[model samples]
Target: MALNRYYYPTKYESRAKVISLGVKCVFISHQQNDKDAARKIADYLINAGVDVYFDEYDGDLRISHQSNNARAVTDSIRKGINNSSHMLVLVSPNTLRSTWVPFEIGYGYDKTDLSVLCLKGIPKGSLPEYIRTANIIRDIYDFNIKISNVLEKSQSLLEETKLMSSYANSANPLSNVMDAMINDPYN
Candidate 1:
């Protein structure tokens, strides 16, 4: 499938701010049977300047060399989730039956700052219970929007954090004294 690179308004101040932020890395979770779809999503994200972490693309050689132990695989997945800013779970009919996807989703939700998104690979009303709580993307168009939104929101949060840190570190003895007085009970 041909995927077009998405462009946001570069002239707008808010868009510019989002653009200036570092690349948003995404960890993709998919069943081994859904590699083709996962690759397409990875390509789209890469073309849009987003970093993608997919085990099929990056971990196959390593896994083959290793003992293929369940603990080893889970550890690697945990590391990927921890390093990524977002997680995209491709939910195909086959994926529903896979054991690893649910574990990846739970690990991502409990262990990291990653925003989890579920992308539908087939027309199905029922989704796995683990992904029901996540933001769902129904098609390629929705996928583009969800990925863009995640990056923009993450950048905004990062900017806000930086601003708050700067303000906190600024020399403000009067504010400190006021805080000290307000909290002091022996005044």
Candidate 2:
């Protein structure tokens, strides 16, 4: 694989953003409809000092994959997943309708540390069955603990962020949409 202008560039090449840290880069998998919630989760990971490959922020991923080229989309996604050590699937009711979410999960199934993070307003048995076996991030508290376990010094950072969520005028650095517990349908 030589770098040449002839090859179609993926997001990593187009953005020129390099992640030197070799540890835990997370590939966030969510349906397009759940973008806002996924962004919040990505933000929390970013705040925790984790490198994330959330497609929304990458213009190259958006531009290259929207041309209806199956190869382009699959390549872009594969690259993102391969570059990551973890995959956090932000599961919501919208996810059930997503074609790509299932693909992402399956492709990264054996490679990345996968976790399914629930959103609000979901029921206990509503989550797709395939994802139930993965580690479930039950709530914000569970998220905090999981992150802390993954990275040293994250506990304090999360505690500080959680405190920030308490301010009435301030938007939660973690999540503005859900409080301590998300809308977990499967408990």
Candidate 3:
């Protein structure tokens, strides 16, 4: 199926400083059933020094279980998905019919380039029909490899962007305008 493309930066006008700080990510999936896997992935990313946003921690503090904190969790999840630069989707059989998952994927689809990890095998006789034609990986092992590849690409881009920004900041005449304003010779 066709999916809507998200807003990717066409040209580097100013500088994407936050982007160069590794992959700041949000995990979008069905939280109620995928909590364990979500937590595992989040923890893995955390240990890898990637900032991860998951819905499990978004709800009411008093509500111990995530099942009891739907409203708050959903709001937080929406915000988190919107704020994140990248999304890691956990796709499975149950995920196809999951109303929330598609919306989450579509949210990422509208906002940014998404990296999807299909923990389960792909469906036969026509795809899930809801999700876009996403690049699928067989399992978490493949997912980890894909994540590694994406991370490497992101890191390289980050470094390149950093250098470009550094050069741009130094080369641009506006740099002097701001600097001169700060270090006023008139003062």
Candidate 4:
């Protein structure tokens, strides 16, 4: 999957600073019928220090014939997906009947580096066709672990990059001093 090639510094310019800031956001996709489950997941993530972009909380619900509200909602969803580091789809039996869920998944896969399928109240053998190909977390424990791992990995990579940069900048001077004698063989 394309997620295998996911890189942090390429996405954010100030890699070390970004990691140190400790702010990770996730856009959640789910059917309106599954709002209760979705809300629970959002709350859990929030308590775990993740910023959640949930449509019911962050989207417009008012409908107007004069205004293009549908388009507005789509734009909001797209922006949310684009801004977030990860997109998590809450998969339930109701998800199979949702038209928007598929669109959200497709957009997330195309636009974001990480798109996770979180199965809720469903059997593993009965997963939908679209969900069958995603990075899936079967339970809340796995979901928590997955998010924690992603954050930890990103922070670790940032620390490694910072160390490498520091070494590259400082080691040249010492190397040059050592090589001074070699360059001036007569000394």
Q: Which is the leading candidate under lDDT?
A: 2
- Give the per-residue lDDT of model 1 (tens digit) for 1-187: 1121112212122322323554356778888887776776666566555666677644533674376677777766765665565778777677778888888888777443333333332334567665666776554334444545755644335335431111133342212211211111111
> What's the number of clashes in each of the models?
0, 4, 0, 0
Comparing 1 and 3 on TM-score, the stronger one: 1
How do these models rank on TM-score, best leading?
Answer: 2, 4, 1, 3
Worst 10 residues of 2 by lDDT: 1-10
Models, CA RMSD each: 18.1, 6.6, 18.3, 18.7
> Per-residue alpha-carbon lDDT of model 2 for 33-146, expressed as tens digits?
999888777777766666678888665567776777777788878888776777889888789899899999999898788998878655567778899889987667667777
Q: Residue-wise lDDT of candidate 4 within 1-187, one digit each (tens)?
A: 1111112223333424434665366778888887876766665555445666676644243232126676776665666665566778877678889877788888878555454444433554676766667776654334544656655644334335431112133332222211211111111
Model 4: lowest-lDDT 10 consecutive positions = 178-187
Ranking by lDDT: 2, 4, 1, 3
Instruction: Please tell me which predicted candidate would have the highest TM-score against the true structure.
Output: 2
Residue 178 CA error for candidate 2 (Å)? Answer: 3.4
User: What lDDT does the true structure give each of the candidates?
Assistant: 0.53, 0.70, 0.48, 0.55
Clashing pairs in 4: none
Residue pairs clashing in model 1 are none
Per-model TM-score on C-alpha atoms: 0.61, 0.77, 0.56, 0.63
TM-score of 4: 0.63
